[model samples]
Target: MNVIKRATAPTPKFFKLLRNIGLSIAAAGGALMTAPAGLPHGLVTFANYLIVAGTILSAVSQITTLNDE
Candidate 1:
Protein backbone atom coordinates (compact mmCIF):
# COMPACT_ATOMS: atom_id res chain seq x y z
CA MET A 1 0.00 0.00 0.00
CA ASN A 2 1.01 3.59 -0.56
CA VAL A 3 2.11 5.90 2.21
CA ILE A 4 -1.11 7.88 2.20
CA LYS A 5 -3.23 4.76 2.23
CA ARG A 6 -1.30 3.19 5.04
CA ALA A 7 -1.41 6.34 7.09
CA THR A 8 -5.14 6.70 6.63
CA ALA A 9 -5.86 3.06 7.26
CA PRO A 10 -7.28 1.86 10.59
CA THR A 11 -4.74 1.63 13.39
CA PRO A 12 -4.82 -0.91 16.22
CA LYS A 13 -6.17 0.06 19.64
CA PHE A 14 -2.76 -0.03 21.33
CA PHE A 15 -1.25 2.11 18.63
CA LYS A 16 -4.07 4.62 18.89
CA LEU A 17 -3.31 4.96 22.60
CA LEU A 18 0.37 5.30 21.82
CA ARG A 19 -0.32 7.95 19.20
CA ASN A 20 -2.35 9.99 21.70
CA ILE A 21 0.40 9.69 24.26
CA GLY A 22 2.98 10.76 21.74
CA LEU A 23 0.94 13.77 20.73
CA SER A 24 0.60 14.75 24.37
CA ILE A 25 4.33 14.43 24.86
CA ALA A 26 5.00 16.61 21.84
CA ALA A 27 2.57 19.24 23.07
CA ALA A 28 4.17 19.29 26.50
CA GLY A 29 7.60 19.65 24.94
CA GLY A 30 6.38 22.48 22.76
CA ALA A 31 5.00 24.30 25.77
CA LEU A 32 8.22 23.86 27.64
CA MET A 33 10.28 25.10 24.73
CA THR A 34 8.10 28.18 24.29
CA ALA A 35 8.11 29.11 27.94
CA PRO A 36 9.59 32.51 28.84
CA ALA A 37 12.87 33.05 30.66
CA GLY A 38 14.01 31.14 33.79
CA LEU A 39 13.86 27.77 32.10
CA PRO A 40 17.02 25.71 32.53
CA HIS A 41 19.17 24.82 29.53
CA GLY A 42 18.91 21.14 30.36
CA LEU A 43 15.11 21.30 30.26
CA VAL A 44 15.21 22.97 26.85
CA THR A 45 17.46 20.26 25.54
CA PHE A 46 15.18 17.59 27.04
CA ALA A 47 12.20 19.23 25.42
CA ASN A 48 13.88 19.06 22.04
CA TYR A 49 14.52 15.38 22.53
CA LEU A 50 10.91 14.86 23.65
CA ILE A 51 9.64 16.52 20.49
CA VAL A 52 11.77 14.30 18.28
CA ALA A 53 10.87 11.13 20.14
CA GLY A 54 7.18 12.02 20.18
CA THR A 55 7.14 12.77 16.49
CA ILE A 56 8.74 9.46 15.68
CA LEU A 57 6.47 7.52 18.02
CA SER A 58 3.30 9.12 16.72
CA ALA A 59 4.33 8.71 13.11
CA VAL A 60 5.13 5.05 13.58
CA SER A 61 1.92 4.43 15.48
CA GLN A 62 -0.17 6.25 12.91
CA ILE A 63 1.12 4.11 10.03
CA THR A 64 0.59 0.80 11.74
CA THR A 65 -2.26 -1.40 10.42
CA LEU A 66 -3.82 -4.70 11.33
CA ASN A 67 -2.92 -7.67 9.16
CA ASP A 68 -5.67 -9.51 7.36
CA GLU A 69 -6.38 -12.88 8.91
Candidate 2:
Protein backbone atom coordinates (compact mmCIF):
# COMPACT_ATOMS: atom_id res chain seq x y z
CA MET A 1 0.00 0.00 0.00
CA ASN A 2 1.23 3.49 -0.84
CA VAL A 3 1.24 5.85 2.10
CA ILE A 4 2.22 9.47 2.53
CA LYS A 5 5.51 9.60 4.36
CA ARG A 6 7.64 12.34 5.93
CA ALA A 7 8.03 15.70 4.31
CA THR A 8 11.77 15.38 3.83
CA ALA A 9 13.59 12.53 2.15
CA PRO A 10 17.32 12.10 1.59
CA THR A 11 18.26 15.50 0.21
CA PRO A 12 20.57 14.46 -2.62
CA LYS A 13 19.93 17.62 -4.62
CA PHE A 14 20.56 19.95 -1.74
CA PHE A 15 23.66 18.14 -0.62
CA LYS A 16 25.05 18.05 -4.14
CA LEU A 17 24.31 21.73 -4.60
CA LEU A 18 25.90 22.60 -1.29
CA ARG A 19 28.96 20.51 -2.10
CA ASN A 20 29.41 22.10 -5.49
CA ILE A 21 29.02 25.57 -4.02
CA GLY A 22 31.45 24.88 -1.22
CA LEU A 23 34.06 23.50 -3.58
CA SER A 24 33.69 26.44 -5.89
CA ILE A 25 33.98 28.93 -3.06
CA ALA A 26 37.04 27.20 -1.79
CA ALA A 27 38.66 27.21 -5.23
CA ALA A 28 37.76 30.86 -5.78
CA GLY A 29 39.10 31.85 -2.39
CA GLY A 30 42.30 29.99 -3.07
CA ALA A 31 42.70 31.63 -6.43
CA LEU A 32 42.17 35.10 -5.03
CA MET A 33 44.64 34.41 -2.29
CA THR A 34 47.44 33.61 -4.75
CA ALA A 35 46.52 35.66 -7.84
CA PRO A 36 47.25 39.18 -6.56
CA ALA A 37 43.53 39.72 -5.71
CA GLY A 38 41.33 39.70 -8.78
CA LEU A 39 38.06 38.27 -10.03
CA PRO A 40 38.01 34.49 -10.17
CA HIS A 41 36.58 32.50 -13.03
CA GLY A 42 36.13 28.96 -14.40
CA LEU A 43 34.11 26.40 -12.46
CA VAL A 44 34.25 28.48 -9.32
CA THR A 45 32.13 31.31 -10.66
CA PHE A 46 29.78 29.04 -12.57
CA ALA A 47 29.23 26.77 -9.61
CA ASN A 48 28.66 29.70 -7.26
CA TYR A 49 25.98 31.19 -9.49
CA LEU A 50 24.24 27.87 -10.03
CA ILE A 51 24.30 27.14 -6.30
CA VAL A 52 22.67 30.43 -5.33
CA ALA A 53 19.99 30.15 -8.00
CA GLY A 54 19.20 26.57 -7.07
CA THR A 55 18.93 27.37 -3.39
CA ILE A 56 16.63 30.32 -4.03
CA LEU A 57 14.35 28.27 -6.26
CA SER A 58 14.30 25.39 -3.82
CA ALA A 59 13.33 27.63 -0.93
CA VAL A 60 10.65 29.29 -3.00
CA SER A 61 9.09 25.93 -3.82
CA GLN A 62 8.92 24.69 -0.24
CA ILE A 63 5.46 24.27 1.26
CA THR A 64 4.44 24.28 4.88
CA THR A 65 1.72 22.08 6.31
CA LEU A 66 -0.60 23.00 9.17
CA ASN A 67 -1.54 20.42 11.77
CA ASP A 68 -5.19 19.46 12.05
CA GLU A 69 -6.77 20.04 15.42
Candidate 3:
Protein backbone atom coordinates (compact mmCIF):
# COMPACT_ATOMS: atom_id res chain seq x y z
CA MET A 1 0.00 0.00 0.00
CA ASN A 2 1.08 3.56 -0.62
CA VAL A 3 1.85 5.96 2.21
CA ILE A 4 -1.41 7.82 1.92
CA LYS A 5 -3.48 4.65 1.74
CA ARG A 6 -1.72 3.17 4.74
CA ALA A 7 -2.07 6.34 6.72
CA THR A 8 -5.81 6.53 6.06
CA ALA A 9 -6.38 2.82 6.73
CA PRO A 10 -8.60 1.74 9.57
CA THR A 11 -6.91 1.28 12.94
CA PRO A 12 -7.97 -1.15 15.65
CA LYS A 13 -9.84 0.09 18.73
CA PHE A 14 -6.97 -0.62 21.13
CA PHE A 15 -4.49 1.23 18.96
CA LYS A 16 -6.92 4.13 18.70
CA LEU A 17 -6.88 4.36 22.47
CA LEU A 18 -3.11 4.26 22.50
CA ARG A 19 -2.99 7.04 19.93
CA ASN A 20 -5.25 9.20 22.06
CA ILE A 21 -3.15 8.53 25.14
CA GLY A 22 -0.04 9.43 23.27
CA LEU A 23 -1.59 12.72 22.14
CA SER A 24 -2.57 13.48 25.72
CA ILE A 25 0.91 12.79 26.95
CA ALA A 26 2.42 15.05 24.32
CA ALA A 27 -0.01 17.84 25.18
CA ALA A 28 0.77 17.52 28.88
CA GLY A 29 4.47 17.58 28.19
CA GLY A 30 4.10 20.69 26.07
CA ALA A 31 2.15 22.44 28.79
CA LEU A 32 4.66 21.51 31.46
CA MET A 33 7.61 22.51 29.35
CA THR A 34 6.11 25.94 28.60
CA ALA A 35 4.61 26.73 32.01
CA PRO A 36 5.43 30.17 33.40
CA ALA A 37 6.23 28.95 36.89
CA GLY A 38 9.79 27.95 37.49
CA LEU A 39 10.27 24.21 36.97
CA PRO A 40 13.19 22.02 37.96
CA HIS A 41 15.74 21.25 35.27
CA GLY A 42 15.14 17.56 35.71
CA LEU A 43 11.43 17.98 35.16
CA VAL A 44 11.99 19.96 32.00
CA THR A 45 14.27 17.19 30.76
CA PHE A 46 11.57 14.65 31.57
CA ALA A 47 9.03 16.70 29.68
CA ASN A 48 11.21 16.60 26.62
CA TYR A 49 11.44 12.85 26.93
CA LEU A 50 7.68 12.62 27.29
CA ILE A 51 7.15 14.57 24.10
CA VAL A 52 9.50 12.32 22.18
CA ALA A 53 7.97 9.15 23.58
CA GLY A 54 4.44 10.36 22.93
CA THR A 55 5.22 11.24 19.34
CA ILE A 56 6.73 7.85 18.71
CA LEU A 57 3.86 6.05 20.38
CA SER A 58 1.26 7.98 18.44
CA ALA A 59 2.99 7.42 15.13
CA VAL A 60 3.38 3.72 15.71
CA SER A 61 -0.20 3.34 16.85
CA GLN A 62 -1.51 5.28 13.88
CA ILE A 63 0.28 3.04 11.40
CA THR A 64 -1.06 -0.19 12.83
CA THR A 65 -3.80 -1.93 10.78
CA LEU A 66 -6.04 -4.94 11.16
CA ASN A 67 -5.55 -7.86 8.80
CA ASP A 68 -8.11 -8.31 6.08
CA GLU A 69 -9.90 -11.65 6.23
Among the numbered candidates, top TM-score falls to 1
| Count of clashing residue pairs in every prediction | 0, 0, 0
Q: What is the C-alpha RMSD of each candidate to the true structure, in Å?
A: 0.9, 9.4, 1.0
Decide which is better by lDDT, 2 or 3. 3
Q: After superposition, how far is residue 23 of candidate 2 from its true place, in Å?
A: 0.4
Q: What does the lDDT come to for candidate 2?
A: 0.48
lDDT (Cα, tens digit) per residue for candidate 2, span 24-53: 655555554455545457745665665566
Error of 1 at 56 (Å): 0.6
In model 1, the worst 10-residue window by lDDT is 31-40
TM-score comparison, 1 vs 2, better candidate:
1
Ranking by lDDT: 1, 3, 2
lDDT of 1: 0.94
Q: Which candidate is the best by lDDT?
A: 1
Candidate 3, TM-score vs. the true structure?
0.93
> Local error of candidate 2 at 8, Å?
21
Arrange candidates by TM-score, descending. 1, 3, 2
Clashes of 2: 0
Q: Residue 35 deviation, candidate 3, in Å?
A: 0.4
